[model samples]
Target: MKDDTKIVHVGRANAKRHNVVNTPVYRASTIVFEDTQQMREAMDGAVGDRKKVMFYGRKGSPTSWTLEEAMTELEEGFDTVLAPSGLGAITTALMAFLRTGDHLLMVDSVYEPTRHFCNGMLAKFGIKTTYYDPNIGEGILKLITPTTRVVFVESPGSHSFEIQDIPAIADAVHSFSDQNIVIIADNTWGTPIFHKPLKLGADISINACTKYIVGHSDVMLGSITAAKEHFPVLYDGRQQLGVAVSPDDAYLATRGLRTLGVRLNQHQENTMKVATWFSERPEVEKVMYPALPSDPNHRLWKRDFSGATGLFGIVFKQTSREAVSAMLNSVSCFSLGYSWGGYESLICPSVVSHIRTASTWRYAEPGIRLHIGLEDPEDLIADLEIALKSFNTFL
Candidate 1:
């Protein structure tokens, strides 16, 4: 079935729920069982192959299970586990595969918090992490050691928007036989509709459901989709950590999935309009969007992804920080904030400088990230034009 069709019907109308359209939020810490045998089965996770039956609330309920099932289907993976946040999903995947003496090869352009996790928490546990250039591709194999247990990747990274060669890296990592190298991709930006990491040879795919999947900017959710060989370890790790999504958030995320197809199409349309405007502006140095043919990673993006979303970056022409701030503050249509993939447009400064260690971020000018929302393209462009003009005043 097509993505749009699947989104609308995937987790809806259960037979036991009187044919309800959506999964009802089950808010409970404990679930009662009618028989001791059933209770034992639930406790042992033998009630269902998918573990959809509730034993304890921390394990999951109907709402979260429904969402997980849909996500697993969407990602074309063996299974999925819920996480409290995107970071939780990342940590879960890493913890599932990494050991104390293990080595992790991470993309330099990964989300800042992910870098923090590697540098701070993972380091404390004696797990060594090596951040490599996002464009390394097959060359990543040279960095792999006998101790390398995980290779973490993020395509068209969060701030720089540099598309990585996912297949090349995946193949290179999988070539190691002495140690099992798990490839984990952060698929939040691409989503399932744009890119399927499991098909690209990744062992696991992580998504920040708080963004596009929730759609409304109200719910915080995350998920980890795993391949058949790695699903057991991921599931066990999640259980060991007691990671679970709120039933209400899960329901909201499931509800948002119904319209993700339509919302993404509109988001792509709006983003292109705004990004193209920035490309032609004298104040702008470059527009960092993988979908743009002029972008350095456009070929890789075209090869790997079907489409782009609303998020991109615009580098100004040698502008002062004060000028950039003035422009951001002056924008009316785009709100100055973090987190994208909502109905409302968002703008924020790029955060690649301080967090980067493996590679240098050498932009000619200051840059700001733009998350084009559901607003009319013309109005958004007008807002940006006014903001650019305000920056000129500061200059």
Candidate 2:
């Protein structure tokens, strides 16, 4: 089925609840069994066949299960596990395959919180993390050690927007027969609509449902979809951690997901328009959107992705803090805030050089990340025009 059709139909099969079109919220806590034998069977099913049974409320109910089914199908994975937040998904997926003394190859442009988890928490657990260039591609094989267990990738990396050669990296990892190395890709930016990491040889795919899946900035949820060989360990890890997402949030995310394809199309169109305008501005040194033909990572993005999303970054040629602040303060349409994928536009300054351990952020100029929402491109451009004028005032 096409993505749009899958989004609308995948989870609605069991909507037989009162003949409803959507899966009704099944807020559950303590499920009771008629007898000890039934309870024993449920317990067995929870461990032996997780998808077919729900032994406890924490395990999941029809509502959350529906969302999981939809996500698993959309991601084209064996199964999926839900998390309370994006960071929860990342940390849990990492801990699933990593053991004490295990080494992790992390993309240098990974989300900052993921880096912190590796450096701060994982470090304390005796695991070592080595940051690798986002562009390493097949060269990633050279960094593999006997202790290496996982490679974490985030395409169009956080803030700087560098697209990794995912297929090349995956091939390199799989070529090494010494140890079974797992590959995890953060699919929040590429999203299920555009990129399916598992199809590209990634072992697991993660999505911060808070962003595009939730569509609105209302709910906080995450999903980890794993290939058949890796689902057991990933599921066991999440269960051991006792991670669970609210059924209400899961329902909301599912609702938001149904419209994801259409919403993302609008986001891509609007973002491309705004990003093109930024490229023509004199104050702009670069527009870090892979969709742009002029971007350094465009070839990789075009090769691997079917579409782009609302999020992208721009660098000012030479601007001060005060100048950037002035521009931010002057923007009427774009909200100066963090987080993206909502219907409303947002802008925030990013300083990534300090966070890099293996990468050199060549651009010393101030960078502004923009989430071009569903707003009309002309209005957003008009707002940016005013902001840029204010930026020039301080310069």
Candidate 3:
């Protein structure tokens, strides 16, 4: 499909007689089969390897397929699966690839929530997680074990903002064995436009659609997109786990994704401006954004990243957590909270220690993550200036 055509109809269909542009949402738990043979066919395989099916609402309704089709087009070589939440997608993708005795290599700078799940749940299942430095690249090969079944990467490591050498890492991980270790990337930050993880060699690209994809922050959804080789398992795992999302949610997501290109552009522009603004501040000792000129991974970022979003961190030297809070609360425009990629700006004190066991988090002070929104940069900067004043006041 052509790019524009793909955007409009890649995952959508005008299947009914009315010929509506968007897929009609069909909500159902019981699908009546006309005959015994029809019932057997419905049970055989809802969606076939060759074509789509109206097999079961659980496999996905037309509404769900519309979104999946669009997402698949955006992510080159990826077959997609939907999850109830971002973590649901994350956990489901992992479950599809890992057996009990399998080992997994993870990035140390993964989202704390993901890290928490890894520590608490994956470990209990007898799956060992070895966290490598985000910058390790092909050097990761030395750390891989025969039992390693998956390599999970969250590039520009969530709050830490460390850009990874994905192509290099992919080449190394794939050489481990024919055991076919899956390369899973949490591509939520980049979506598919800015960075095509699958095209770069990842086996799977997962997203917390709750962030940018949904745009409104009103919906909670996640997606796990798979390379052709692994699409079957992703879909199978989602099917068995009963990961069907509501049609209403799917409709909202579809609408939100239509504006993703424009929204992401604004987000990138605002984030660069905000990161630079924070970097020059005396109170901020370090800015943990890959786009920063002085960042350790700046070259890698420039080479691989088409853009960025509002999820960068700023560390204040010699400032207490209370001081950071005071400033964050003082800001008129930057509301203190979690979750990002919404139209409204948000600020939060970011804590990244769960996976910091290998390296000491020896910053002079704790850091705060900010999500710059569509607000005027000047107004946002002015609000931040006042917030800094409050920080100084607390000092």
Candidate 4:
């Protein structure tokens, strides 16, 4: 079935609920067994079995399982694991694969907290990390070593928005090493709709369901979908770490998944309008959006992704810090916030130099990231025009 159809039908229609359209949230902690033999099976390695039977609350409930199955269908993976937050899913994936004395190749333009995890926790655990440029492609082979165990990538990165060559990197890792090296991608921005990293040859794909997957900014959730061979390790690690999401949050995320395809299309349309408007403005130096033809990574995006979303960046030509602040604060419709991929629009000034280590941010102009929402494109453009006037006054 097509993706849009799958969005509404996969999770709810196939659910094993008793003649109900939606899976009922199972708030479970202690699962009762009829006999000692049943309890023994649950306590033994049989708990690892893929059967839908509940062993413990920390493992998962039916509500969370419903979401996981839906994500697995979308991601085209063997199974999926849930976490309380995006960072939690990221750390879990990293820890599950890497061990002492292992080396990791991380893309430089990854999310700030991901960089923090590599530099801090992974470093402390003796797993050395080498940050490579996001556009390296097959040249990533140069960074790999005999001990390299994993390659972590994020396409159209969190702030800088550089699209990576996932298939090239994945093939390079497999050809260069026979150690069962894993290729992991933070698929939050692309999600499964636009880009399925697993199909692009990645061993695992991850997402912060808090953003677009939740559709609203109400709940925090994360998901990690793994290929068949890699699913065992990730699943075992999640169980060992006791990482599980709230059942109520899972229900909300499931509901959000139903409308994700339509919502993302709207986000793409709104973002294209705003980003194109920024391109024509005299004050704007550049608009960094992969879907834009003039963008540096447009070709790569066109080759890999089926669509684009709301997030994109803009750099002002000759704006000062004060002017940037004034512009951001003056916007009537766009709220000043960090998180994106919600129904509401948001804008934030970016300082890429503060977070990156492998490469330098060359753009000297003041930069801003925009998350265009479900509002009318004309209204958002008018709000930006007003903000620019305020910025000019400050300058």
Candidate 2, superposed: residue stretches over 4 Å from native: none
- Candidate 1: regions farther than 4 A off: 13-16, 46-50
Off by over 4 Å in 4: 13-16, 44-46
TM-score for candidate 4, residues paired by index: 0.97
Candidate 2 residue pairs in clash (backbone atoms < 3 Å): none
Candidate 3 vs candidate 4: the TM-score winner is 4
Model 4 CA lDDT for position 84? 96
- Give the backbone clash total of model 4: 0
Clashing pairs in 1: none
lDDT (CA) per prediction: 0.88, 0.92, 0.82, 0.90
Better of 1 and 3 by TM-score: 1
Worst 10 residues of 4 by lDDT: 44-53
Candidates ranked by lDDT = 2, 4, 1, 3
lDDT by residue for model 1 (92-207), tens? 88988898999999999999889999999999999999999998999998999989999999987988999999899988888886677899999999999889999998989999
lDDT of 2 by residue, 1-395 (tens): 89888999987876888999888888878888999999998888888547657678899988898999999999999999999999999999999999999999999999999999999999999999999999999999899998999999999886999999999999999988669999999999989999999999899999999999998999999999999999999999999999998989999999999999999999999999999999999988889999999999899999899999999998888978889899999998999888998888999988889889998998855778999999899999999999999989999
Better of 2 and 3 by lDDT: 2
Reference-based lDDT, residue 126, model 2: 98
